[model samples]
Target: MNVMKSTGKFRDESLDFQKKILERSGFGEGTYAPTSLLKTPPNVCLAEARKETESVVIGAIAELLSRTKVKAEEIGIVVTNCCVFNPTPSLSAMVVNHYKLRDNVVSYNLSGMGCSAGLISIELAKQLLQVRPNSYALIVSTENINDGLYFGNNRSMLVSNCLFRMGGAAILLSNLTSDSHRSKYCLKHIVRTHKGSQNHCYNSIIQEEDDDNITGVTLSKNIMSSAGQTLKANISTLGKYVLPFSEQLRFVTNFVAKKLFFKVRVIKSFTPNFMLAFEHFCIHTGGKAVQDEMQKVLGLSDWHMEPSRMTLYRYGNTSSSSVWYELAYCEAQGRVKKGDRIWQIAFGSGFKCNSVVWCALRTIDPTKEKNLWSEFSTHVTN
Candidate 1:
């Protein structure tokens, strides 16, 4: 406190801004933050950063292997994503070393991909499984922003402090025919969109050093606009693959008729009824504002958006892993039926939007599955 006061960094006005952000964040008191960050004078350091990540990442992986009854050696591919914290050895290497995975394991660590990196990792794993027969892939999605908090006076950067909280997930993927019966869901389609070509889009949400030389992720007001535009491009490609022929033809006919009727060269508005393609929606729980914006853009009902909104209020923003938490909420509520098409959508830094579609092989058994939201599931009908 003395050091912060001496430097005239922490001010009374900043407290007001943070307090306002907290009220509208839709984050409950249960949201987890690393103990280091909760300190009066935050004990932010490299060692603490490493400890924070490993605790979440490794613990999640251990629980995954235990529940799945799969040995670490059986994982032929490992993909780990930690957007803000990429160490010298890489997160994948850490998983490899901890699990004592095979020497020939195909491993990768991705950074700077932001919240959408989870779907990117899943997309990569799904593709790899096709070529590498009889193999299993493990993906760990997390954010280690415990030490990345902004202490500077930049309000854009201050948004980061309110938006993110601690969370991680470990997912196992397989391609073996023998494991087919055991697999819960199968990947149907994945669409990735990037708008980084435009300078404004690329700078939508970025990590940089402030004037005080304190580094943090800057989230501009343009983030929602960039996300909405990029998602238009993403679902445009995804629609052809997932939407029924009837829905597709209707959308095109209506779109063209509007343009022709108005004699306008372009139609600035069009959103396919994603409900036609998906039975369940798992939009990323980035924050209250992002969730609210996407809800409007997608024209989703409160029922379809319950998991996302609930996850945000419960777990806060887990970055790349937020979608998984949302999906878990659906499963916990016993809403996933057999043959259900689940749409997982995410918006990230680099002004990227990605969608992963899945089909459940069988009706999920809530008791048999990992019930992350069991406590809330009882009282919450949605």
Candidate 2:
């Protein structure tokens, strides 16, 4: 069981001005913005967004292959995810052409699914490895902010403007027995959960508008609340399947104590220490508030969220690709080691929550490739 991860990122620094974007978008004075929106044109539009996305995907795939010492034609599976850009040619189809991968390779383009698409793509690749041994799977995660930039200055919509930046990540997964000894991590378990809420919850997270003259998509305001509930449920369900017996017993004990003894104080005190179980957490850098909520729920410390926070501050919210940036940060800091455990959590459209857990199979070599964190260390906030 071996896997290699190669990630890529691209941002439109000239388009958005950080300080003005924060104030105009109402993200507050201290809210981090990679670039300001004032510098960017109001009519930049989706066409440009698609072109930038194409560049990142092409560049990322090329970089991944170069680092892995594998040719594009050797890749057996291609999985790409993006929220805003869906062209007639399709992003995956374009990549297939750009890379000239084998004609028989399975390629998929996942759209409309929000940030959680990153983990979902990884899960898809892991499943492929089970059936097709020695196969190579390329997973690319990205988000196009230019398409979703809001002009009305509504706080809810403006949040997207301040938080999202241009970014993408490409990862290479393989089940080759030969690479097992050198690969950094092995995929262990993946849990995906979706919530169905009609009261503008789903509409808030993912919206389709029809105005006769034009049709467009916009994010609703209720996404954070809806996502919080969904994540709690998903974590509980996943815990039942993966938590160690001791932790399970503790949870059960607290429940029983509260029910029988009516000891509300003691029972309510029981919360699973997720961070204690996993050595590292690559939580989606969707926003500062999202990260804070996840940290409080998961019982993680400032250090646990350092990678996520740094990624968010440096790259803004790259949506699906943000988790990979956090993962890369941990690796560059030499935080991951053989047999260490890592947990990746992401929330996206469809009111969806997805999680993936992996264990390092071999030591990571920082010198082997470019690292987003290592390069941005000077600028990242502690």
Candidate 3:
């Protein structure tokens, strides 16, 4: 399966610029410097965080619905993924309440699924659409980093302070047969891989603390490395399915070229050309190292990594919504085209790795819509 057509929506960028934001937010020097949405203090009350989260969620949904020209009442299913801010009324319920979705609308709230939750939710929506044919499904992925901020000054937790940002994203999915022609892309394939180990690799990055109640999560170094391993395994499994014959040929040819032909390309260095297989790549913006390692491992060119790198530089790591920002950037630049393939890869705790493949359904016209990309494009370097 491939992305036939897809669109993403987020809050306007001018509202939150990366540099000035960190300094004013009281974040430690150079902590939130890399991210546009500055991280707030861990002591920041949950109530304030909840309000901010709801505003972004509502804004994102409204933006998506408006762009897709779909009425809120017409959406038959709603799914939201967020690790922070679990309320008595679930996030999905809140969405239903705000939008006044139909009583018959199917809704769910997913918690504790790490960054991979977004991809997992998208896959779940695809499955639901298949079973309940000809229905619209809305999937929202967001993480309120402001609430989860860690002001402990501990290096382990400090990493989160530097990267994570306040952001959310909403997307629409459908199985309407006609949608195959007009929709973004047909739901091609979704691959989920979890490497739960004895050492609590699947442990929650965000936790509930007693007196020392902290909101933000601490992503351990072990969790990061584990994610890389899981992603490699997952993509390999997915590769067996959607990779085109030409891609397979190039992979094999390159492997043989490096080995038997004694080509300058190192035998150990030869890797599958993910860029050759897909026109666009949306790797997770976990960090600079994560993005760089993925580019080196998968043999992706600098151009392929631009969206990921730029998103990280501008928005920091918005967790689940980061990939959507990258995809939005590509669309804004007029880079996406009809029949183009998009590869979205995300890493999360649970030592989880997930990948989704989307192919464009039609050529898209770049629009100067109200989004993070439009404003931050000039600020970012590459």
Candidate 4:
């Protein structure tokens, strides 16, 4: 009787935690879940999970290929990332088999990299393009929420069940300068910070079985602290590439004064105004709390955060693809202009923070674009 009472209290606490999270998560009613998860009892199985990914990846790729009018045979490289739900043949193989890509096509599948895996895929494609000139690389990013849902009474894991929703993106890249005229953006820089060497950071987010033996991903409170540390480390390198000489010099002087000269109290260190480096920022949309924290840390106005905020409200935290969705939101709003620099910041399970920079190659006309939030543009709240 005593054990039963304690278990019931834990269950109640988990339910209360989930309810509170949902109340403040910034998720809208339209956010999605896989058809399988929508069932009365939530039918979870390997077969159903494949169907969920197939429907998303195929639709995303088919739409991209149709809009760009690119033949699958022309794709020389394929990269796909899903933090969970990796199968035997792999998602890259699935894409190749479905589209019948050429036999010589190079493909890779990335897993367990967390929400930052999308930018990682883009970085991978960029490197592949450097070697194979005039080639097109296709990158796909998505998360399988069906496999990640937690029915156990672990309060930490329940946070994911309330925050993540179904979302994905398909991106096409090319090295052919001839395609420049029609390109939307040009890749500029990438900086990745990994903190897995620290035991706390590595264990901050994990998939494990609870006392009842049901498996789910536990999101420790330390996850946010790990993310904050990674962000500082990532921007340290990224700032060198993007910040102007003036900002860089100021940072260096402060570091030298504080560290080398042993006068920490004499000179105050500060975070550089990233706004001066990029016109837009796509902060990782892990949850509303994360966004709120970022807003305070980065000192961004609502205008700068509009794309990321609206993406979260409409799509929830879609894992790796959230950044692309934020980018699409910017394009749909017609905010992308030629020569404008955009920054994508991503945080993942390795306690990693990664940055990807892009410069707009051409002004994006919203009428011709078909973003997930395109139809709702007229009704999107500020």
Candidate 5:
């Protein structure tokens, strides 16, 4: 990765700033850095943006196409999402042009959707697939950290600089019955809950200029509270679809008792045991605090949280792609099995809590060598 080369330059240029952010941020010393920051002149220009896009999106797409043996012309629809970087030609357009896709191929570029945008793109792809039979959709999720780097002294903004890193993921979704036989997982359900109507939720993560006109994404202090509120709302809806009958009954009973029986202290609040619903979890690698809170809220053990923690440590927060890395980690660890349900939950800037439930269609071998987590297998397995 270009990150290793840039580490020295970053430290030499701004050692104190990097040190301070590292001390407080949940990132380790090995998080990926953008090539933009590593450049001699430190590029944040259009060329740099395209380079980053090509390096991640194109590379991932090539690998996906090669593995799936799907030609570029077969992609009926394409959706690419990036929160901070949206060029004039659009990233989707670039992909279409690079791959020489069919002129009628539907393409969309989603921007400013934040980390949860990956699942959002998947949700969109699922909807599109319903309309177009026997078709495939390509989804690319990435963040341009080079352009998003914050040089200002704002602590809230600096946190983003420390937390976010370079990464991307490309996923191919097919609705063809034939492809289903070969697919690793099947999309079961997607639940998206947005709390942006509330002021705090809207401002929880935002891009704005500091007093010195330096731009950065500022994370608000109320992020944790806002995230909790949104997660509660999201899971409440998600529970009805995925939770077992017995768990649903218990949750409803507790909720009713808490609401109707004001004088009784029988139940404070209904916290459904998410562990009962899903066999595995691919929670967004937002940060240490977010992962810790999610583990506690869902009553997950350290084994269940290994993917999120390890992803954060290894890649930092890759924005929308973090969840994919977590999923990949589970596959590398051989934790995902046939018929096992995996829940991917992510929180975004809109104070959105989005979840996608996937059922493993086939067992994945833990000995896969090409996976991103393959290098860290020893550490993860031990």
Candidate 6:
């Protein structure tokens, strides 16, 4: 609930760039960036990156441990992900050492997986839990902007500076049925689709040195198009597991008609009514354009997108952890309820579209405790 805001010094430093890009970026005035960037001199360095990583990861992990009432030694697996920063001692290793976890704990560090890495981590944890019964897995999602700062005038690269911000989330998953009584939700399905083999999709968002020799992640003009393709593919696979029979039959009928009977463009592609399958949606707050495109493609209404839009306005694109912030926003607003289903969809650099489905296990009270969006009503307009 006590999410840190960027210092004035850092805001002042980024003011010029923000002004230039904010108009077209779909971001509000309140988006966050890291205070570590305000140091005497700023560039990608291990010290600054490490400091930012520890601040968010440790805080989130501490809160998770307290809420779950689980000790660090009880965690049988640890996974931490950050797209741009990978130090000598992995982030997972740092966490294990700092928390003094058990010596035999399985640890994995993931990097360069982009914003969808958080969901990827969850899928990994689910697999690990199946192998080891009655064990807990800790997953941390974060992004460090210290090394991702772009100095060049390349507008595409400069967009990252305006969009990405400091944020992290820690999640604890357990295989024990006993813990299910206390858990907020139960994992139902996870479907991941990757279009990395395609040249255009692979280069849509990439980290490389620009012409000026300044290294940064560049966003290509084809990013939206690439994402759309990946989403289509992902939904095709996911629909089998989540969509209602009526929706599935319609989709199949449309497909058969298009191939067998209709040669003229009479039938439009069927976008299964996802609204029937899930009560809530946590679309990645990648950018304004991406959010808008998703809303239109999925036939979603304004209410369905409020969490994503507001999360972007409040946190900027926190990379992999953005989805969690959106989910927290929904909880703080008292929108979640027992038996309701939530679908989290995330897009990342590999032109990946990943989704995680959860069924609420118990009723969630908005006023039960403070949350990331505890003050959301006072500050956010919508």
lDDT against the true structure, per candidate, is 0.87, 0.74, 0.72, 0.87, 0.87, 0.87
| Candidate 2 TM-score over all chains jointly | 0.84
Please give the lDDT score for candidate 2. Answer: 0.74
lDDT at position 280, candidate 1: 93
Residue-level lDDT of model 5, residues 206-234, one tens digit each, is: 99987767777989999999999999999
Which 10 successive residues of model 2 have the least lDDT summed?
A: 1-10
TM-score of 6: 0.92
Instruction: For candidate 2, write residues 231-256 as lDDT tens digits.
Output: 87787777786678888789888778
Model 3 collision count? 19
Listed in order, each prediction's TM-score against the native is: 0.95, 0.84, 0.80, 0.94, 0.93, 0.92
lDDT of 6 by residue, 247-312 (tens): 999999988888886776977888999999999999999889889989999999999999998888
- Kindly report which residue pairs in candidate 1 clash with one another: none
Tell me model 3's lDDT, rounded to 2 decimals: 0.72
RMSD of each: 2.0, 7.9, 9.4, 3.2, 3.8, 4.7
Give the candidate number with the greatest TM-score.
Answer: 1
Instruction: Tell me the tens digit of each residue's lDDT in model 1 across 1-382.
Output: 4234232365677778888999999998888999987676777778889999999999999989888899988999999998889887888998999889999999999998999999999988888888889999999999986666777778898878888899999999998888889887988888999999998899999988888887778988887789878988998899999988887887788777886777665655567888988989999998887778888888899999999989888899999999999888988989988999999999888989999999998888887785678777778976
Worst lDDT 10-window in candidate 5: 1-10
State the lDDT of candidate 3 residue by residue for 98-160, as single tens digits. Answer: 999999999988877777789989988887877787799999998875556553323445455
Ranked by TM-score, the better of candidates 4 and 6 is: 4
Q: How good is model 1 by TM-score?
A: 0.95
**Model 5: how far is 334 from its true place, Å?**
1.4
